[model samples]
Target: MLDLRVFENRELAQRILMAITREAEMIGREVRLMHVCGTHEDTVTRSGIRSLLPENIKIVSGPGCPVCITPVEDIVKMQEIMRKAREEGEEIILTTFGDMYKIPTPRGSFSDLKGEGYDIRIVYSIYDTYKLARENPDKLVVHFSPGFETTTAPAAGMLEAVAAEGMENFKIYSVHRLTPPAVEALVKQGTNFDGLIDPGHVSTIIGVKGWEYITTEYGVPQVIAGFEPVDFLMGVLLLLRMIRKGETRIENEYTRAVRYEGNLKAQELIGRFFEVRDAKWRALGVIPTSGLELREEWKELDIRNIYRVGVPKLPDLEKGCLCGAVLRGLALPTDCKLFGKECTPRHPVGPCMVSYEGTCSIFYKYGALF
Candidate 1:
């Protein structure tokens, strides 16, 4: 039988934490490291790593959760597509990952649309949408492609597959945002986090070199980290070392998956079909070249064109919603009055509480509200 003790290596964890603490103290400065991955935030909070760290060492959560950053307008636009198709007496199938179903918009969610007699299916992969398109050529199958670089690779591959097969029924409503531009926007806004623990999965596709501009221009150190406790601790250690030595560079702690240059074929596929454009994040307003749109060459495959629809402009939220501040790292979940009591995960008034990777969801799951 496998020993459980192997997984519960508390002594090693303590040593790593102590080493980071010691190194941070030697520098005579507070080490404020921002983790740019929601999974890392959840892991650190659940493991009580924040309590274990020195008082001077702080970890702030960045805009790493894709769902939290997705603008309300995109959700509104998706609902409009569904409503339009139903009025024309045509079958419109909306497919996306399960997490997106519960994400609320100014109108409602895919779940709400499904309740109103819309054919919205929760698909595990984009390939599933392609298969459905092949089987039901008569129906309009629109896949909601809302994600960052980590998911864009597979979504790009699916587009390629659809193109190769010449499937006209399948369409992708893309709200895919890139990572490097978002990070650059944060830096340009004069945000003052000392270092960044870059996203591991995103780094796997875009690589460590993707953050070169942040280091060269903003003089901030970045380390791509894995999801493990040791990996996070080591990332902190490396960032502290960089700050102490007065060096700003990009490092990859999760070297197993990421390299200096990422997957070339995946990048090529994304370049072939998508072009960068200004996008409005839910919290952060419009950031130039932060979003990906389907290229003009592939306009025929674009759902927005086929449906003759455009993304709508949504007004600000109702009172007592600080989702924008939270996503910008200006506030935490606990800072909001409606965090735990009024805005629990079960009945989320904001998008941050709806998705599993959201900061509010992380706090709710790990009992951080109290």
Candidate 2:
């Protein structure tokens, strides 16, 4: 059996830290590295990895959190559905991840709607939403699916199962998106990060090969890393080494779970039910081929088709919320004026402070040491 303790070994962490220092010193310039994973940020901040690293070496965050990237328009659409349901005296049950429940939209949050006697619920999985649909045949159950590749696979599997059964009461509002396009958009928009620490969880589904475009196209190297401190440090080391060597390629540090080709079965399952299209991200606007839509065959279960919901012409973010800059690697969570005082977990001013995977939330939970 593998010893889980090995990853957290203090002595090993020191050795990695020393190597990082040496690499950063050899690089002899300001090296800005960005990791597109909220868990990576948590590990970096919680482990005080930044405090240990050379001052010249900076680690920034990208648009990694699925909840952070989920467009406010999607929430508005759900709100419209709820309003129409109540007006028409229809029982419409809306289900989504717990993090999404507290996200503030122009029409307030799902929690607010629930308080007003709406059938909005916090579900752990698509399976839970399915169970709710099965139990309540009279109500229209809508699963507000929002995630990257990691969560999309399971949602696709559930969609397949639901379609096979021809479940009429069940519907899905898919805000599922692809990570690569968003990453590419950052590069195109000039975020100014040297290397990337690719998200380990997302890479497990999209595969190590999924990040090759970053190197081949933008000439930026990336390393796929796990959640552990050692894994994150090692990823930084590998990326720095690659940069020092003047090489651009995608490296995998989390090999135990991720593969070159990725989970083919999961990919196939997703392809059958969803198609790639331009998607509207919370901060990034619309990115081509970044969002997933249900295939024509599966359109019968798509909420967007059955229900017409108008998202108000509103700013993507709330007043004084710096989540957009934070997600784009242009600013840190601490840079936000509303980070600590006005925006705590209890009261979130933006989606970034709401999701566990959001950079702002991670930084709030684990104070930035650097």
Candidate 3:
């Protein structure tokens, strides 16, 4: 096992900080870097990395949090499934990650519906959801699956398992998304980012090579970094060096876990069970080929295919919420007027405030570190 403490060394962090300061001075211009991982945001905020950085080096949060960026339309569809089930006097259980349970919609949240005797469940993994289906053979088990590559692979594995066993009780409502396309959307839409910090967890599944297209086509530099303070700081330093040298390529700082080719088995599993599709995000509209849906062969196990829940058309974010801008890296969480006041983790007005991985929630919890 890797000594996790080595990655958190204070001495190394200070050295990198000094190097980052020097690089910022050498560059002699403002640099904006965006990272698309919730854990990266937590590391940046909780470790006080932002406060320690030179004023010219700014880190922007991207649509890293799956729960935060999950379109409200998908949530409404899940609710619609429950509502329709209730109307027909059917007992169906809705399962999702804990982070996804409290995401608010116009019709309230899964937690709210759970309070009102809806069969909503918080599960840590797809296996737990599968277990629910096995335990209650009579009830329909619907998993509201939403995530990037890291979580999606396991869902595929479970689906394969379900198919092999001929299990019909469990179904998945796949809102799984792809990280590369969203990054492409940000680049294509002309988001002002100098460099990209590829997410460590997602890269572990997709591999470092998966993000090469961003640099190959857009001439943008990227670095895959872990969630540790040193890992992030090293990624920033690598990006700064690339930026200064006018180099456009990907560097792997989290090589201990991530690789150039990534986990082939996981990638194959994902491809086996899912197909690329255009999907909606909370703030960013429909990004082309940015989402995953179950393959036609496995459509029987898909919840969206099985249920005809009428999803009402709804706006991405609530009125006056800047989550859309935040996700696009156009604004900061603090820039929102309601960030600390009206929109909080306790009572989120927008999707960004609801999840711990959300930028607003991280800033609210650890902004005091600054």
Candidate 4:
């Protein structure tokens, strides 16, 4: 375990809050800050950090939760693909992380499909899927991979390993995305947030320098941050400092883990197996080059290509489901009419309620403050 002592001290936290309060007061305007990671949302909310922020300073959730942002149409498309494979007399096993298994779609969840004996398996990581593929060579193993750059790296690495070893039976259905393009979309759409409290896990993979364009183009400051309560407070303080000075640049509050160039080895692995393509965001729609796809050289390993299924068309949002607004930072979890009434963590109607790191789930657990 990490012995990061200063971060845990209540006195230090109080002092940081004071500094943030001072900064917010000096600015004397509504300071809109967006934290673009689900883990960060959990930290800010679960720790009651949002409740502690100055009334004038609002911290909002962004396009962070991977599962929450996974378009319902994509989930539906995967369900159809798995069903089709079964109908075609192919013994197939669909593997994905646990968070994805319960994300509802028009066709219900993969869990529902599993209950019907469709062979949906929840694996911890891509490597585990690889092992499963190896053990059951008789069945077609389709790994349903999803997440941001950090999770994408390992999935890509596994695909590379499959290519090297010629694992013909293994394929990947990639829902992995890059964070930069999403940030750009928010800026282009005029989010008007004072600064970004960036995700540390994503920054650890893509590095601090990857966010340079957001500052250069949008004049918005971003502070890379860790998952701890103290890390979040420090990130906000750094942002406040930037906003007060009328500066727009990338700052690294998560210095202990994030580096200038990020994890090059992971980048290399990602580059080797995947390429940037125009991919869909559930709420944001298609942001050009925001999503990752298998390279042409490895197209045979793409589940879409192998199954002759095109990119799923985006569907209309469920009636009264404010998940779209929530993901875009346009609204809060409590703002949705269905939040606590029709939707809860136990019986989630939307993807946002299903994932542990999702804003709706976080808010449901911690209650909304802003």
Q: What is each predicted model's overall lDDT from 0 to 1?
A: 0.83, 0.89, 0.91, 0.86
For model 4, state the Cα shift of residue 296 in Å.
0.6
Backbone clash total for model 4 is 0
Say which candidate scores most in TM-score. Answer: 3
RMSD of each: 2.4, 1.3, 1.1, 1.7
In the range 1-370, model 3's lDDT, one tens digit per residue, is: 7789988999999999999999999999999999999899999999988889999999998899999888888888888888888888887899998889999888788898899899888999999999999999899999999999999999999998999989989999999999999999999999999999999999999998899999999989999999989999999999999999888899999989998899999999999999999998888999999999999998999877776867778877788999989898898889999988988888899888888888888889986873
lDDT of 4 at 205: 93
Error of 1 at 233 (Å): 0.8
Query: In model 2, what lDDT does residue 241 have?
Result: 97
Q: Estimate each model's TM-score.
A: 0.95, 0.97, 0.98, 0.96
Tens-place lDDT digits, model 4, residues 327-346: 88889988899999899988
Better of 2 and 3 by lDDT: 3
Candidate 3: the clashing residue pairs are: none
For model 1, how does the per-residue alpha-carbon lDDT over 70-184 read when each residue is reduced to its tens digit?
Answer: 8888877878877777777877888988878888777887889899888899988888988999999998899998889988899889899888888889999898998778878
What is the alpha-carbon lDDT for the whole of candidate 4?
0.86
Off by over 4 Å in 1: 1-8, 310-312, 368-370
User: On a 0 to 100 scale, what is the lDDT of residue 31 in model 4?
Assistant: 89
TM-score of 2: 0.97
